[model samples]
Target chain A: MVDAGVNMALFAVVAVGYLALTIALGIYGYRKTLRNEDFMVGGRKINPVILALSYGATFLSTAAIIGFGGVSGQLGMGTIWLVALNILVGLIIAFIVFGKRTRRIGKRLNALTFPDFLGRAFNSPFIQVFSAAIILMGMPIYSAAVLLGGVNFVVASLDIDRNVALFGLAIIVTLYVTYGGIIAVMYNDALQGGIMFLGMLILLAVTYIELGGVVEAHQALTNLSPQVPQPLSDAGMRGWTAFPAFGSPLWYTFVTTFLLGVGIGALAQPQLAVRYMTAESGRSLNRALMVGGIFILVVVGTAYTVGPLSNVYFFNTYGETSMQYVGQNADMIIPVFVNEIFGGSLFGELFIVLFLLTLLCAAMSTLSSLLHTMGASAGYDIWRHVRANRSGSHTAEEVLHGHDKDLVRSMRAARIGTMVMIVVTVIVTYYMPANIIARSTAVFMGLTAAALLPAYTHVLFAKEPDTRAAKWSIVAGTVTWLFWGLFIQANNANQIGLRDALFPAATWPGVPYSVIDPLVIGLPVSTVVLLAFFLYGRRKGGL
Target chain B: MLGIDDPWIWTGHLFAIGLTLFCLIYGWLKFNDDGEDDING
Candidate 1:
């Protein structure tokens, strides 16, 4: 896009202007962080729009646009099913059912972090510690996923070297998050979400118009079925506009891994759940719901739409489908499409920079939220309990029930925890395999869902909230997921290399077990364990 | 109907729009309800 001097200068001016605005917001968030409460959840008084925007922005990162969007280009419109579930489950059910209760119960418990919320609710510090450990370990994979999406876009569009772009992006996110925590994260997310929403809507309309119209665009992509690559066709890819044939490996991966894994797994995400606690009241969350819904639709819906349809543009232009054109890295497709269509044209350079800004903001929003959650879990849930209890003045249990505890050092500890996690995340990002964004996201989300969802739901609704049921269910879910992920499912087994080292091949020769997501097996097992234990608890009159 | 003939694909698109519209109406209807009331507790 910056091939000419005039365009390069305009790009620089736009980049600088965007950076100035971001820095200003960062400073405002820093000044606003006068207390630990403000640092964690914005004093529990964040407005509805900001809450909605923050939630939406954090939910749909560059991973969604750059990673999944590229997959849509490669795979087709079947990914739209994910958008449907994202709205119904991720947005609607989340706000109306989970959010209201989380806000009310969070306020009642005086919980500052998600693990703290669980720990206080279940009256088990062990639950807090274990869940915190889970977040600390699993979140880096997702963080690396987001980090790579942003870096890849930078590498593709700006022609920057991969390592420099990776660390540079990481550093900018770190500066804002470490200083101001969730306040900085949410405020920046609001602006970022707004810009992304606008950009995507325009991109969607233009992409369709560029291809001829909505119907024309769809027809064009549908007609590319003959060119659907050989292995993919063998794996049941019908076309860009159709779902994979039922019972095929691609279908299992599509339905189980992407659609169900990401869709349902969104509920128990600590970063997203923590956002509900930021709102002042259920009414604010209620008002924020539709805004979040639309933001998701326009942002994710557009990405999914534009991605697969990019094939039509490429086919018409380059005489190859997107997969054939981009080679093995589906990650490069969207950025390449953006550049080819937008770069080197009159006034296209400015739009190109804005698109880059949208992606950077997305990476920042999601990364900051992940870092903050990890940091809070480490500092407040794990370390504070250990460190603060050394004095023996008050237990974390007593502190949750309204006993006052000094928290000044806890703030410093959280920032330090954030820094440590950032280093780990940067290392993970440095070595992450290519085209891993979507799969890694599904892995992390599925892990959280399996580990926390059943227990979390039980605590939300049960008056007495049986601790034994929750505790064992958490363990059962986690073990099942890990065993399947590491030993059976090629999706993770291939990445983690446990199954490969142990066995000759990644998966069994017999069936589709390799592609079936761990969530399918883990969640049901977790739920059964929870129900069994809860029934026993009730029979024992523990309720 | 939108040129993509697959029932699953079109239905998925319609479902997404339908859910978002439902959320929009729900938000408007419940905008001024009790801010702190909770049935769960």
Candidate 2:
């Protein structure tokens, strides 16, 4: 075993260095920020390259590195297909199909944030406020999930208390985001992303070296057992070279959870959407695609591959289930494996530093973006109503001036709101439920896809969106997802009850042989509502 | 078990590591140019 004292010292130096870099970036970003637009959208002058890296960095996060990587370890190397989908659907399709139009419309509308963009596009303050509220409520869970990633690594490497780690992370993240805002976030994202790329490369190299070779690793893994688990024992469990058998649960989870959820959901992501408005023009947006694609392929692709292959290493060393080595909590697998690999070697201390840096950057970049989005959305969408209500008390010129001040105040509120969000996330991290990343991402994107995807798709491709239909579609999708997430799916199986329970099985009826995720039910319902509304509007000469 | 043996697989991994490092360096240069433009602009 490695000396705990050396590990602690290495972890502290890395943590302090990361904190100092973030604070310096934040101070710089704050000084450069001269207006609300500059703070919120990086003055809409962000070059394609930084925008691309920031987007990929935010998108990858701890969710991609630790959560998905852990899942890949158990699910086998077939998960690489999801990485391909992330590049294709998440990056390419998002940029080419959705990004160009989003930038054009956003520029035309002078939209500074995602909710602001939506509100202007739809010509509805209600949509803006509604979307902003959704972000404020939903973002904490996602933030907490990211916090868990860093906290887990800290506990594994330095043996620090999880609560202490959580508090330290929350404070550092809040300080940078609260001061520097989006520019600091993006600048730091590019640097952290570079480190992440290098860290994964080192991990892949060492794992391959220790395992002897690719062929030997495969033969050892395959010959060991076919009876270990439902998914891992299958022929597909070897490495990144093969796909799982058709119709298997592993395949479904890959497609639904990682591929479809993250892949398609990236287009509608409020944080990423705001990036389009940050760039100068369509060309900058296009310029970003190559750099973004390669970064995603390297950082995400490496993490996913290392995740499953770690299984082979752990199994060989411990002579027991890899699960026994890392426990049922999949997030711990990567940290545990890293510690084991570099335990007593000179490389051990370096690995510890790199691992903590990777997680801290992952947490900071994702949290800053989420907080900024929340602040901007709340200020423009939610607070606008309060300003409008008090308008009757003021004269015409006074009202106009009040509106300007309200915009400023809303920006201030966003900063405060981010701090509030960080505290809530830290508290929640103390009492987290199981499958933190998968469940949280599922709920978040499921809600987003259900509520926003239908309307967003219409805005992008539909010739004429029936406003009435769009509103109803969003409402139906949003309500349906919320109902299932809160009521139908019990916190535990023992908590299942009548209205929440689906007859003939635990899931809602008519979605037989399925758990009836809201995306399954709400997405279809939203599409039907939108089409019906469009048809009705045309019939009434409203289109 | 489908027993398979090949010495080249070890070499393949070494090749992959080399290729990964090469790509990293290439990407760093390309991204660095763009980043400089962003900072200047």
Q: What is the DockQ of each candidate?
A: 0.76, 0.07
For candidate 2, the docking band is incorrect
- Candidate 1, RMSD to the unseen true structure: 3.5
Query: What local lDDT does model 2 show for residue A223?
Result: 54
Candidate 1 falls in which docking quality class?
medium
Question: Per-residue lDDT of A40-157 in model 2, one digit per residue for the tens?
Answer: 3563566656666665666688877777777766665555656666766676667656776777777877788887776666776667767777777777777778888878777777
Candidate 1 lDDT tens digits, A80-135: 99998988888888888898888888887878888889988999887888899889
Question: Model 1 off-target regions past 4 Å?
Answer: A1-7, A23-51, A180-188, A385-406, A503-509, B38-40
Lowest lDDT 10-mer window, candidate 1 chain B? B32-41
Clashes of each: 0, 1
Which candidate number would show the highest DockQ if scored against the true structure? Answer: 1
The TM-score each candidate achieves on chain A is 0.91, 0.86
